[model samples]
Target: MDLDEARKLWHPEPGWLNTASYGLPAEPTWTALQEALAQWRVGRNAIELWNESAERSRAAFARLVGVPAGDVAIGSTVSQLLAPVAAALPPGARVVVPEVEFISNLFPWLAQAERGVEVRTVPLEKLVDAIDDGTDLVAFSLVQSADGRIAPYDEIVAAARAHGALVSVDATQGCGWLPFDARRADAVVVGAYKWLTAPRGVALGYLAPGLRDRMRPDAAGWFAGGDPNGSYYGPPLRLADDARRFDISPAWFCYVGAAPALELVAEIGVPAIRDHDVALANRFLDGLGRPPGESAIVTVDVPGAEEKLERAGVRAAVRAGRVRASFHVYSSEEDVDLALNALAG
Candidate 1:
């Protein structure tokens, strides 16, 4: 796939570099949404249609993250997706998390304290070292949101598994721009609004077979069952055996957008996407006279750089006392040039 396909999807006026905060949706997402609205206006709202759309989205996410569709769950947000996971763990279980993490990954595990579980927060460097035989869960972010630090997550995952601890990852910053295996973690939670280029209000989750078999479906609902159809008319509660048991009903419009967004990403493939983003990010770092980093995020420690870049029509953000410029598949060398010149100014 060429940049033309991505360019035609969303055109930010010029010098828009804030894609890490929120991605621009493709034209197909809009068209699909309008079609859904039209169907609703005509009183043709069908539950079957919504189910089919959600299935399409689940399949796309599974393919993207290298998991089976049966292992994927749908939710409105990453926090919402993770709440059930927190509730399902045994009481008094020791949970290890990083001191620096996006709150979505932090709060839920911390909230488990009310259930008598112990939550330990350590520095990201010591996260894996903190895990032991007594630890039941390890929750962390694959990419640090503030400073763009990509953690050595595979080592952590292996350590957790070796210690018999379940690992849950908040992959919001790293999911679409990079390739990751869902099977590596017990659970992987993601919000689609950022790197995935879908709208807000939809998140994708993956539960590994081991975790899926062990945890109870604490938040099971009408749609969170083996046959939502048979469950609707049969027993009061008959949940599915797979990850679908954790699936919640999502906003239909979000699914309309997500299906196309994920399909496009799948067509482009994450390997190619990672290479493209890394190249652009390295170019941006080099342009700023900084060393190359591993991921698509480049953070410069220049004073007042965020405001200066903004005034120069280059979009960037100040996070943790550094100017963070996040590159994506849609970013071009021209965008980096504009940003470098603006930084120099």
Candidate 2:
């Protein structure tokens, strides 16, 4: 594929570079949004419209990650899907997670401590070590948002399974930029804004077959009862048999806005996108001539170094630093060079 043409379709705006974070998909997603909005204006019930969009979105996500559509659920955020998984854990069972996981992955399990569940923080290197027979659940991010370290997911999943533990992955940072093997995870959750080039307030969750029924829906609503017919006359509600069990009617406009973005990604292929990102990251790394934190990212070696960086106004100043580029299909070698040159100065 022509990189430039492909980029044009993948990026919505020119010169608004995004190296510190990933950019959403551009043209195709915008088109999908318009179509979804038009459909919504016809006075369709919000729940019905969301569920219909959810079906299409799920199918697209399943195809991207190589899973069955039945395993996918539309969610508003990663935390929303994870809340149920945390709620369903056996009382007093230990949940293991990396020490530096994003807040979305950390707080939900910590909340479970009130229910007698034990939350254990293990170093990234010791995540596998923390998973033993006593561990009932293990959760981690596929890519650490701070340093951008991609975890060895297959190994982690295998270790968790050996200990009779279920595994959940937060793919928010990695989903659109990296290729994921869904069969290796018990469940995977992602927010579309970061890498999929979609609008915020849109996300997807995938529950392995048979595992959907195991999760207690923390945000269960009438729609989750599986009656798209608008009839709520069912016995004390059971979560839907499919991943829809996690569905809460999300904002229809946001869902519509996200569709084109994901479709653009689908067209380009994730592996191609991953290759593009890795290449760009390599360029940034090589230009720094050492690990990040020295020339780029403005990080320092201090106690709570990461926390200090955030407090120092990193996100706002991200574009002014040596590492001022963003990750997107349209990001260019020239952009990488410019970031490197700024850091070299």
Candidate 3:
């Protein structure tokens, strides 16, 4: 969609925060959410009815990420999905993760450490190296949350697969803004809250074709089992063959909330969204007024600098005398201009 059309869809009030950390969906999110709530109330306590909506939401997500619907598992949280994969790993197996990964990616493996699994924490460079044969699984975020550094997934996947290691990605920060090839990894988990603009308590897990069968469901609820045909007794009790087996306490509301947001994203196209975000990021970067060597985002180092920027109505990180201003599709040129003028002042 063109900027003017896109602007009408997103009518953010002045002074609203533009942090992608909280997640931002396309303009139709509110309308979509209202519809979702209505459907959920109508289907409450009806398993078969709810599954229909859930399946539809899965298909929507699958299309968004370019995967088959069968590979998608709807979850309420990223941790819920990652937990199963972590439990299924061989005991004492080393799981390599980046030193700077978000806590969501780290906690699941840390839980494994409590179960006698070896959690190997290393810098991003070492994590890359450790994806060799001895590695059981390698987990990392597609984008580093703190600095917005995009990880090279192709390289990481190539290294992991060469060693026969499974690769799991926490794509929370990258999904709506980046092109995510879920088919490229063993499994990828993401929350709709951050980038997808869906309500909280809604997340998704996309398991590569054969990987679904490998995960031992960590918290299997009644909905996880059953044929939905009534012949099955006591909720079937067996995990599903598809990614749906990973779901716990099926959330119809979250499913509903996600529908419109994803629909809008599909309409806009992810590549177009990325281009807009990158342009905004560039504008913010150029406003720094520093020499090329020190113009990098997230590298500024001034005392109490982050607070100062915040007071100026700018969100940024100061490291090594450089200021890193994160920008998103909703961020206007005026935002960059303000930050630049503040630096000049």
Candidate 4:
């Protein structure tokens, strides 16, 4: 795919490289959101319309993440989805997580400690070995949000499988730029604002068939049960037999935007996008004369890092005394050159 073609979809000034923090939504996504809002204003958007939109959005997400549409649950945030998944575990169960994971992925499991659940916090390097026979669940981010270090999820998944432990992944940081199967884990949760290139307040959770069957929904609402009239009224609440049982009411407008975002990803194809992003990241690394890390984000220690990037007309995050330049389909050779030169100076 021509990078210029992808770049035309967003309104970023030339050389924006901060997709890891916030994505510039494609023009079509914006159009979809506006069209939904127009329908709402004109009284043309019935609950049925919104429900159909939700299903389409869910299916699009399933396609992007390599999961069956039936296994996908809709939520508004990672924390919203993670809490119930954590609560559903048996009391006093043992759970393991990485010490340096994004806090959204860490705190929910940590909260399980009040129930006498053993939460083992290990460094990323030791996360795979941390799972043992006693572990009931193992949760970690696919890509570390801070340093962009990709987790060795295959090893962790293998370890979890050997020990009969369930696995959950916080895939928000890696979902769009990196390709992987969400079904590999028992559950994978994502907030769509970042790399998914959608509006905020839309999140996705995928529950494997076995895990969905074994764990009951902890956050049951009327929508989770899939009522035909699309009514939010249920006297005796009945939950869904599938992953929809865990879903919460979504922002309808957000779903409108999200569907198109996934469509763009599917059109360009994830494997190609991954190759493009990794290549851009590698170029940045090579320009800096540094070794490549696992994913599209490349970080280097620098003084006044954020200001340097800003002066170079690049957008990135500088944290922990390191400058992190993240690439996506829209990033180009010019962006990397500017970032490398600014960092070097």
Models 1 onward score TM values of 0.94, 0.83, 0.85, 0.94
lDDT of each: 0.84, 0.71, 0.70, 0.84
lDDT of 4 at 70: 86
Off by over 4 Å in 3: 1-4, 14-18, 25-27, 35-53, 226-239, 290-304, 315-325
Give the lowest summed-lDDT range of ten residues in model 2. 293-302
lDDT score, residue 46, model 4? 67
Candidate RMSDs in Å, in order, are 1.8, 4.9, 3.7, 1.9
113-197, model 2: which lDDT tens digit per residue? 8779998998888898779999988999987766556788888999998888998999887888788797789889988887777
- Could you give candidate 3's per-residue lDDT for residues 1-345 as a string of tens digits? 564567566654332234445655554667656655675679645555545656766777898888888788888888888888888887788889998887888888888776688888777766677777789889998876666677778889999988988999998878877887888899899888766777788888898766766667767665565443442566336666677667676576666667776666666777877777677666655566433321112344445655655767766554335455555556677766776665555
User: CA lDDT of 234 in candidate 3?
Assistant: 61
lDDT of 1 by residue, 1-345 (tens): 665576667656667777778887777777888888888889995657766878898998899889999989998899988888888889998998888788898888788888898988899989878889999999988888887788778999999989989899999998888888778898999998888888898899998887777777777777887787767665667888888898887788788888888888887788787888889889988887778988887778876788788888888777778888887877788888888888788
Better model by lDDT, 1 or 2?
1
Give candidate 3's whole-model lDDT.
0.70
Whole-model lDDT for model 4 versus the true structure? 0.84
Worst 10 residues of 3 by lDDT: 290-299
> What TM-score, to 2 decimals, does candidate 2 have?
0.83
Give the RMSD in angstroms, all C-alphas superposed, for model 4.
1.9
The pairs that clash in candidate 2 are 18-325, 18-326, 19-325, 19-326, 24-197, 25-197, 28-260, 29-260, 29-261, 33-256
Task: For residues 132-199, write the lDDT of model 4, one tens digit per residue.
Answer: 99999999999988889899989999999999999999999898878888888999999888888888
Q: What alpha-carbon RMSD in Å does predicted model 1 have with respect to the real structure?
A: 1.8
